[model samples]
Every structure is written in C-alpha cells, then in structure tokens.
Target: MKILVIEDDRLIGDGIKAGLGKMGFSIDWFTDGKTGQAALAAASYDAVILDLSLPAMDGLDILRGWRQQGHDEPVLILTARDALEQRVTGLQQGADDYLCKPFALSEVAARLQALIRRRHGQLQPTLSHGAVTLDPGSHTATLNGEPLALKSRELALLQLFLLNAGRVLTRAQLEEKLYSWDHDVSSNAVEVHIHHLRKKLGSQFIRTVHGVGYTLGDS
Candidate 1:
C-alpha cells in the first residue's frame, strides 16, 4: 500500500518510514504540513498518517481542507495530543483513526491495514483470486495451497492486482503505487516486477491490454 506521512520530528518520521517500508508499504514522508498537503493534492495514496502539530499549517486545518476538497482518502491521526477532547476533535475533523505518540509501529501498521481495507470495502484479512491468496497481516502469499516466495515489491504488485481484479492498471499507475519519492527507480522497474510475477504466477495470470496496460486474468 502507499501512505503519506506528515510528521515534523525527524526520529518519528524516519522510524515510521523505515518500519512501514519493511512491511510492504510505499511511504512518502513530508516534514511540513503544507508540503504534505501539496503532495497529497498531486498524487493519490491508500491512506495518510498525519500529525496535529506542524509548520505552515496545523493538521486539523489540513484535514478540513482535504475534506472540503472531497479528498476522502482514509486518514489516521498520529500525534502527542492524547486528551479526550483532542481525540474527539481529530475524529470530528475527518480522521478515520487516531494514535498517540510513543506508540507501537505494529499498531500503526494494523490500523493502516484496517483503514485501507475499510476504504476498499474489504472486510477479510486475506485477498484472493482463484488459487492465489495473500494475507496482508502476515505478509504472506499462497498459490494452489502452497507457500509462495515473493519479494516485497512483487508481493505489493500482486496485492494491487488482486485489489483491482478486472480493472486495467497502466504502467504509470503501477509505478506510482509501488514506489516512493526518494527511490531512484529505473526505466524498466515496473516491467521487471511484472516479468518476475508472471514467471512465478504463470504467464497467463496477468493479461496485457494492447496499447493500454494490464489486468488480472482468469485463474
């Protein structure tokens, strides 16, 4: 999944980026709230992790603006403000979930999973298409009831395909969803991942739409 994290503290930001990155998430982190908001406007993410205190703009104001603009991506408030009113206020401003500082990375990951799943109207913890099944909580995949060995990027790509089964996803969209801003992506990165997945999951698993993109094939 892709996530936008708006946090000012270097330690907290780095920790979130690193921790979440290892868990099969593409994360774009911005220290300033304005910059983060601009990033959100420019691109799409599965969810957002926002901090209340920020420079240039407060988190609540950012949330309000996004809601006003009809950007309904799920947002999880991550801040030090732990009072009852603060929590209620954050929720009222449109945050889907809330977490205080000094929190567990596992909890953050779990909450993000829930938010993204809820956004997609997916209640099950695992995503499946025919013989292929992926468990996001465990970061594991199975094919024909056998364990599937996939790299993180490959797993992410498969997850995207499973999420949008019949829809064609262009190369650009795949790239955007799989990579973060800081990475120096090669020209053939998306193709390389696609090739690897096709090799493992059978060549006919992903159908190529002529002059368009790719879509999940019949299992």
Candidate 2:
C-alpha cells in the first residue's frame, strides 16, 4: 500500500518511513505541510500519517482541504497535543486515528495496519493468494501448509506480489515498496529477489514482462 507521511522532524520521519517500508508499504514523506498538500492533490495513497505542527501549513488545514476536495482516504493524526479538545477537533475534521508524540513505532504500525484493513474491507489478519498465505500480525508465511523460509525483504516482496497478483509491477514500484528512499538499490536487486522467489516457490509463480516489468503467472 502507498502511504504519505507528513512530518517535519527528520529523525521521526525517517524512522517511520523505514519501519513501514520493512512492512512492505510504499512511503513518500514531506517535511512541510504545503508539500504534503501538493502530494495529496497529486496522487492517491492508501493512508496518510499527518503531523499537526508543520511549516507552511498546519495539519488540520491539510486534512480539511483534503476532505473539502472529496478525498476520503484514511488519515492518522500524529501530534504532541494530547488535549481532549484537540483530539475531538481532529476526529471531527476527519482523522481516522490519532497518535501522540513520543509514541512507540509499533503502535503507529499497528494503527496503520488497521487503517489499511478497513480501507480494503478486510477484517481478518491473515491474507492469502493462491497457495501462499501471510499473517501480518505475526509476520509469518506458509505455502501449502509448509513454512516458507524467507528473508525479511524476500518475505515483504512475496507479500506484495501476492497481494497484487496478476498485475504488472515495475521495478520502481517493487523497489519503492521494499526499500526506503535513502537506500541505494543494486542494478539487479529485483532480479535477484525474483530469482530467489522462483527457486523457493514454484517456477511458474511469476512471469517476466520483457522490457517492461513482471506479473504473477497464471497458476
């Protein structure tokens, strides 16, 4: 899923971006609220992590503008203000979830997962595609009732492919989901991962689209 994180603090932004990337979510971050608004106006995202205090524009205005324009995507408000009134206003203005400052990264992740689940109308924690299954809560996977031993990135990659089965996914799309913006990807990193997946799963699990990207094979 694609997420937009509007945070001003570099450390906090980077931490959230990295943590979510590891969980197989594509992330784009903006330090200022204007840029965040621009991003929201430009592209569709599964969810948004918005900070209340921001440069150029505040988080509340951003949320309000998005709603005014008929954007109904889930938004989790992140702020240092824990006042009751602030929470009410945030919720009243269309914040789906709220996280206070100094919060645990795990909590943020859990909330985001919940939002994505709601967006997709899925209440169950376990996701399946064909013979493969993934448990987001436990970070576990199995294929045909046998455990699928996979590295973290490999697992994330598989989950992404399974969720998007039969859809063509470009290298840029895969890399954005697997790695953070700051991480440099090797020229053949995606090819290497695809190779490993085919070896471990069935050879017919994936199909390469010459000169374009890849798609899941018809099983």
Candidate 3:
C-alpha cells in the first residue's frame, strides 16, 4: 500500500521508508507537517505514519485537520512521546495506532499492517478466499497448497483485492494503494496489475464490472 510518512527526523524517516519499502509498500516521505498536509490534501494514501512533534506544524494539529477534512484512513503515530497521557491524547485525536521511538522496524511494519487491516474491518493477518491464501509476513500467496510466484506489484494488487474482497474497487482506489506520490504510475497501471492477477489466479477469481472496476469473487 502507499503510505504517507510525516517525520522531521531524517534517520527515522529514512529508516521507515526503506524498511516499509522492503515489506512491499509504496512510500512518500515528508520531513515536515506542512508538506505532509499538502500531500494529504492532494492525494489519497492507504495509511499514514505521523510523528507527534513536527516543524511548521505539530503532528497533533495535522491529525486533527485530517480528521476534520474527513481523511479517515488509518494513521499510526510514531513519536518519542511514550507517556500514557500522550498516547491517550493521540488516540482521542484520531490516531488509529501508536508506537514510541526506539522500536523495532519489524514491529512498525507489523503494526502498520494491523492498522490497514483494521481499517478494512479485517483482524486476521492472513487473508484467504477460495484456494488462494496470502501471507503478509512472508509476502507469499498460496493456491491449492502451492505457492504462486508473483512480482512485488502483483502481490500488492492481490493483497488489496483480498483485503477488500467482494467490494468493487474503483481504478482510483487501486491506484492510490499501488503507487505513491513520487512514483510515476502509468495510465493503465491498475489494468496491468489486474491482467497479471487474472493470469495467475484464474479469471474467475477477479470479476470485472464493465465501465467500472474490478472485484474479488468466487473462483
């Protein structure tokens, strides 16, 4: 998924970008809250990594403004603020999850995945439909007990479909999930991914709606 990261710390932000990218996500990193807010207002993101303290604008105000503007996407607060009251305030202000600094990179990826899943009302780490099972941790998909070889983008597309299984996902929604702001997405990017998925999972698993979009259904 595409994630918007708002962190003033260069090291932390770079680590998050590289770490999450290795886990198969498109990332857009902003070092300050103003640029982060501009990014949020301009495009849609699958999730956000927001730090509590920021330059130009504080993270709390950014969170509050996003909520006021109706950006309900999952947000995971990443900050050095570990006090109970600080965490509570962040949650109350609309952060979907919280993580203090000095955390394991693995934990950040796991928690971020959890927030994304929860936003879709899915609690399970792995998602399955019919003979296809996707494991986020291993970045693998199995069909009928055998693994399906997939490229990163293909896997990302499949995960998005499986997460919102049975829902008609628009082209715009799929694009937002697959490409970040800095990434140059082709006009037929979603179509290309869908075509590849059909080639592997069988055409029946993904149903196309004429003049509309695609949906994950029975195989």
Name the runs in model 2 displaced over 4 angstroms. 18-27, 41-45, 70-72, 209-212
Candidate 3, 50-151: lDDT as tens digits: 998999999999999999988898999999999999999999999999999988988888887888888888888898999999987778999998999998
Compute the lDDT of residue 167 as modeled in candidate 2: 82
The positional error of residue 113 in candidate 2, measured at the CA in angstroms, is 1.6
Off by over 4 Å in 3: none
Candidate lDDT values, in order: 0.94, 0.84, 0.89
Top TM-score hit: 1
Candidates in order, TM-scores: namely 0.98, 0.82, 0.91
* Backbone clashes (count) for model 3: 0
Any residue pairs clashing in model 2, and if so which? Answer: none
> By lDDT, highest first, what's the ranking?
1, 3, 2
Better TM-score candidate (1, 3): 1
Model 2, 1-219: lDDT tens digits are 678999999999999888877766668899999999988776667789999999999999999999999998899999998999999999999999998999887888778878877777668877777787777655678889899888777777776776676689999888766764556889899989999998988887788998889888875
- Stronger candidate by lDDT (2 vs 3): 3
Best by lDDT: 1
